[model samples]
Target: MTKVIAIVNQKGGVAKTTTAINVGAGLAKHNKRVLLIDLDGQGNLSRGLGCKTKARNQFTIRDALLNIQKGILTNPTKGILTARYEKISVMPANKQLDAFEHSLKGDLDAPFYLRRYVNTLRQYFDVILIDCSPSLGLMTLNALVAADSVMIPVDPEFFGVEGVEQIVAAMTDVQRKMNPSLSLEGIVIVRRNDISIAKRTNAKNLRLRYGSKVFQTELPTSVKASEASARGMSLLEYMSWNHLARAYASLVEEVLANGRN
Candidate 1:
């Protein structure tokens, strides 16, 4: 049984896509067959994994959803395209995904669309990581409905804290009305500079409020992360010796441990 995890944050620039790309890579590095689903319309995860949107066929998640709605029993794994990385497959998203909001309108089961799609691929991979957009809209709701657990990446800033609150509230709603099995896998504090007293204090408060849900590993903001994405690589592939890569590696272990139980 594959664990479906959504890497989400209502706030952008919090390393959400960065975490999804590298963490999925890290899991694959550990021999776990991972499928990365780029649910964000920006297609950042698709590009980060070296997949070009222009080269994709009409068989995207959009088409998969339409087929499923027509009772076609479309297999989710069929929509996945291989990435440059070994053991990692991707369901690449295109900018047209933004139209999903309009496409799903007047459909009562809209929230469960992704859940039904992922159910078809549950046995094909060890994990399915959803790279969600930074908003609590239709797309995010679909990802939440599909996810067994969620990982939120937060920057060490005041607005990040507020974003955490909004995410928690949304999770609560999902648990109550949509996905009763939904759990918050962890809260990752990214781009932390321990030398800054304010950052350290903010991290401390975050831990105090969230308790063990806070991840033990903190990912520092590194130029290597951006450079790796620009070069169509993960941090582990771009700067294999960097501390950030090592941190993500450790984070994957923690995620797997939590997920297995």
Candidate 2:
């Protein structure tokens, strides 16, 4: 069975897309067949994987969902793009997705569209990771409904706890009213600078509150990571010797262990 995990956070700039890219790449390194779904209209995840979202006649996540909604048939692999990386595929998205969300208004079954679409592709992949937008809107809700689990990324900021609270509340609501089997995979602390007192305190507070739900490995902020993303490559592929890349490797180990449990 395919394990679908949504990389989500209600707040932006917390490395949500970055985490999604590296984590999916890391899992692929372990020989896991991974499919990345870009649910954000920004299309950052697609670009980060070196996908040409603006290329002529390129089908996007927007097209896939709308096609699913309208019951239109084209090709089985209509919207999926093979990334340059190993063992990974992507369903790209673009700015047109923002308008696509609004068109689903008044549609009673809007929230289940992604779930329905994903059901058709479950047989081919070992894992599916959905990188969501920074809001808990209709698109993110669709991700939640389709996913078996969610992994939240948080920066060590003052408001990090508050942001986690909101997403957890949304997860709770989804559990009650939608996908009852959905679970929280874990909370990953990203972009940490241990030298800063405020960041240290904030991270300590998060661990104290969330306890074992927080991953033991925290990702350090690095210019190399940003540069790698700018060049459309994951840190592990761009600079495997970097400390941030090693940290992601450790996190992937934890993710695998958690899956076994």
Candidate 3:
């Protein structure tokens, strides 16, 4: 059985994609087979994992959903694409995904497409991480409905508190009206600078509200992340000896412990 966790945040620049990539990669390094699904049409996670989403025949998550909807692809698992990282697979997405979402706009079952697609790949992986867009739209709703749990990466900035509130409300709605089995994996505070009073104050607020849901690990701002992305690699592969890698590794441990698959 695979534990499907969606790395989600309604606000951009919260390191949602970074957390998804590193956590998936870190789990892979633990000898656990992991698959990363890029739910965001922007394809950031796809590019971060060394996948260039260009041609339609390449088969993205969007293509899989559309193909399944149109009766073109019978097996949803066939859409899983191999990434550069070992022990991990990816269902890449690109800008074309926007059109696919539009195609399913008012369809009653649109929110369940990802759940149906993930059902076919459950036995093949230990974990599946869906990197969602920074919004509470249909795409994010699909990921939330499909996932067993959700992990939010809240940046330590001012609006991070508001972002957390918005997501919490959405998650509550999902559990009530969509997926009743949905659980919160954890809330990770990203890009924290302990010395900055503003960052410290915001993080304190998050802890006061979410309490134990917040992970102990706080990922600091790192130029290495961008450098790694430039080279199309995870932080684990980019600089495994550094603190950034260790932070992500610690987060992975929490992720594994929280998720019951």
Candidate 4:
């Protein structure tokens, strides 16, 4: 069965996309067929996976949503970009998603559209990870509704804890009203060198707050992550020996251990 995991955080720079990219890569490295869906209008996830998406790129989540709106399931694989030697495929996004959301204003089923779209994709891949835009909007709602679980990437900073609270509340609301199946899988601390008392305190607070729901794996601040993004590649592909790769690989194991729980 296919499992959908949405990596989300309303705050930007929290490594939501970074977690999505590397975790997908990590899963693919283990020979899992993965499909990454970029729901962010910035298309950073798409680009980070090596897609050179342009302004006029119409082949995106927009078209897929439109198809769902038309009461049909779209064959989105036609536009999915292959990466990491075909172990991973991505449905790229563009600025068009901004307009797509605008067009969804007042649509009662805006959040359900992505669920409907993803329902058609479960058979093709072992995993489908949605890289949500840094907000709890219709897109993220849709992601939550479609996903089996959510993974939040919290930066080792003050606001990171606050943002996790916001997202957790939002997910609870979504579970109550939209997707009762949506459970928060775990929270991963990112950019965490833990070199300072403050960072260590923040980590402790998060684990205390979320308990075992917080993932044991934490990614330290690494320049190699930035370099990998600059090269439009996953850290594992860019430098397999990098500690970041090892961290993400461990994260993948934790995720699989969770195993639809």
Q: Highest TM-score among the candidates is held by which one?
A: 2
Candidate 1: residue pairs that collide:
191-221
Enumerate clash totals for all models, in the order shown.
1, 0, 0, 0
lDDT, candidate 3, at 74: 72
TM-score, model 1 to reference: 0.94
Indicate the residue-level lDDT of 257 in model 2.
90
Per-residue lDDT tens digits of candidate 2, residues 1-261? 689999998788888898888999999999998899999989999999888899888899999998889999767567798876545799999999999999899999999999988888888788899999989999999999999999998887644677788999999999999999999999999877656777778788889989999999999988897888778778888998899999999999999998999
Name the regions of candidate 3 deviating beyond 4 angstroms: 71-73
Model 1, 85-128: lDDT tens digits are 54589888887788866788889888888899988888888889
Model 4, 1-261: lDDT tens digits are 889999888888888888899999988877889999999999998888778678465578778888789877446566777863436799989988899998999998788998988888888899999999988888988899999999998876655477688899999998999888898889998867757777788888899889999999998777898799878888878887888888888999999899845
User: Cα deviation in Å at residue 95, candidate 3?
Assistant: 0.7
- Which residue pairs in candidate 3 have backbone atoms (N, alpha carbon, C) closer than 3 angstroms, thus clashing? none
Candidate 3 least-lDDT 10 residues:
67-76
Deviation from native of the Cα of residue 73 in model 3, angstroms: 4.6
| Candidate 2, position 197, lDDT | 77
Task: Quote the positional error of residue 86 for candidate 2 in Å.
Answer: 3.6
- Residue-level lDDT of model 3, residues 176-249, one tens digit each, is 99899999888999887656787788899999988999998999888898888777789988898778888999
- TM-score per model over all chains: 0.94, 0.96, 0.95, 0.94
